[model samples]
Target: MIAQDIVIRPIITEKSMQDITKKKYVFEVAKKATKIDVARAVEELFKGAKVQKVNTVHVRGRLKRQGRFEGYTRSWKKAYVQLTADSKPIEFFEGMM
Candidate 1:
C-alpha cells in the first residue's frame, strides 16, 4: 500500500500528544494491518524517518446495550511507533497550540 493509503491519520489526543512530546507516538491503525505494515506506513508517512520499534495490539470492541438490544462495537488495531533517537519525533497535534 502507498503512504497515503497506509496511514489513515495520526491519532493525537491529550494522551498521545504528551507521548509525542516525550518521543513516543501512538496511532489507530487498520484492524488487518500487521506490525511490519505499520512500520512501513509510519516510515512512509513521516518522510524518511526510521521506526525504531513497532508495537501492535488487537483491540476487542466493547459491548453496548440500547433498550433490549445488545451488540458489540467493531474491533480495531492500535500501533505504538517509536522513532529512532536521530529521527525527529512526529508532530500531529502539537503545532495546534
Candidate 2:
C-alpha cells in the first residue's frame, strides 16, 4: 500500500500525548498494513523524521446495546512509532501541544 494509504491519521489522546515526550507517536493505520509499512509511512509523511521502532495493536470492536438492539463498533489497528534520537520530532504534533 502507498504511504498515505497505509497510515490513516494520528491518534491524539491523553495517553498518546504523554508518549510524545519520549519521541513516540501513535497513529490509526490500515488493518492490513504491517509494522514495516507503518514505519515507512510515518517517515515519508513526516519529513526529517526517522522511525527506530514500530509497535502495532489490533483493537477488536466492542459490542454496544441500545434498548433491545445490539451491534459492534468498527475494528481497527493502531501503530506506535518511535523515532530515532537524533531525528527531529513531528512538527504536526508539536503544534498541537
Candidate 3:
C-alpha cells in the first residue's frame, strides 16, 4: 500500500501528546499494516524525520448500547513511531504542542 494509504490518521490524546516530547508519535493505521509499513509511511510522509522504531497495537472492539440496541465498535490498529534522536520533529504536531 502507499504511504498515505497505510497511515490513516494521527491519534491525538493526552498520552499521545505527551509522547511527542520524546520523539514518539501515535497514528491510527490500516488494519493490515505492519510495523515496517508504519515506519516507512511515517518517514515518507514527514520529510527530515527519520523513524527509529515502530510498535503496533491491535485494539479490540468494545461493546456499546443505546436504547435497547447494542453493538461493538470497529477494531483498529495503532502504531507508535519513534524517531531518531537527531531527526527533526514532525511539523504537523509542532504547533499543537
For residue 2, what is the lDDT in candidate 2? 94
Candidate 2 residue 18 Cα shift, in angstroms, is: 0.5
> What lDDT tens digits, residue by residue, belong to model 3 across residues 44-72?
99999999999899999999999999999
Clashing residue pairs for model 3: none
Q: Which ten residues in a row have the lowest lDDT in candidate 3?
A: 33-42
lDDT for each residue of candidate 2 in 1-97, tens digit (9 for 90 to 100) = 8998999999999999998989999999999999999998888989999999999999999999999999999999999999999999999999878
Indicate whether candidate 1 or candidate 3 has the larger lDDT: 3
Candidate models: Cα lDDT each:
0.76, 0.94, 0.94
Candidate 3 has what TM-score? 0.98
lDDT by residue (tens digit), candidate 1, 1-97: 6656655667767777767755677878877777888889888777756898988878899999999999999887778888888887554544743
The residue ranges of model 2 lying beyond 4 angstroms of the native Cα positions read none
